[model samples]
Target: MANATSGMAVNDDCKLKFLELKAKRTYRFIVFKIDETVKEVIVEKLGEPTQSYEDFTASLPSDECRYAIFDFDFVTEENCQKSKIFFIAWSPDTSRVRSKMLYASSKDRFKRELDGIQVELQATDPTEMGLDVIRSRAA
Candidate 1:
């Protein structure tokens, strides 16, 4: 497993790059574990999330892991269009976790995120995921 410092460095690099692009109207975000340390950083950067979900654990075909999703919204002043930011956390190992972020303005991209997870779940034990897991937690 990678050291905590290295993991944090990776997260920081991604966060910095996201901010740089965000200033130019490009919003790109990366996901990382949500430990106490990371939680503080996230709150500082994006303020409170519009919505957040608790950890959902499941036994995947390849491994057992926990997942959580967070959503943040930014409304453009000119058009009041809402741009979405999604942060997904995946922990394949109890001791190590990683995450991914999606910045989207279209419904298609949002559907794609859910579709990807649905496919993964289908490959594993579907019962491991609650019926309302994705809809209630993510949407």
Candidate 2:
């Protein structure tokens, strides 16, 4: 159902894919885009389980806003392997203001549909969502 306040609808594929990633490690990340003409958010890309963070970063456009989730895996100081789901709000500086505003307004509604996210990151530039930063947060 689309929320009355934002008129943003999260596609069922988004949740189904997220569940596969969170529970089965079937994907490395998922990229979401808002289709204003449809007034709905849809899956733009599904990163393969073998995809690297660099590949995930490359999936994002230089001058557009996107919502994505990365299955971040890391080892703790004690050498325990673990993973965390990262919800990223990507609004690049070069993106149009109108597109940014729409994504910003609809992010919360869309994120709420994905239940397993453990980390939330809002990045205007790549540096802000660097691996080191994600690693530190995972630690």
Clashes of each: 0, 0
Q: Per-residue alpha-carbon lDDT of model 1 for 26-51, expressed as tens digits?
A: 42322322234543122112222322
Q: TM-score for each prediction?
A: 0.26, 0.97
Candidate topping lDDT: 2
In candidate 2, list every pair of residues with a backbone clash: none
> Which candidate ranks first by TM-score, i.e. highest?
2
Cα error, candidate 1, residue 3 (Å)? 11
Candidate 1 segments whose C-alpha is farther than 4 A from its true place = 1-12, 25-80, 92-139
How much is the lDDT of residue 15 in candidate 2? 94
In candidate 2, how many Å is residue 24 off? Answer: 0.8
* Global local distance difference test of model 1: 0.31
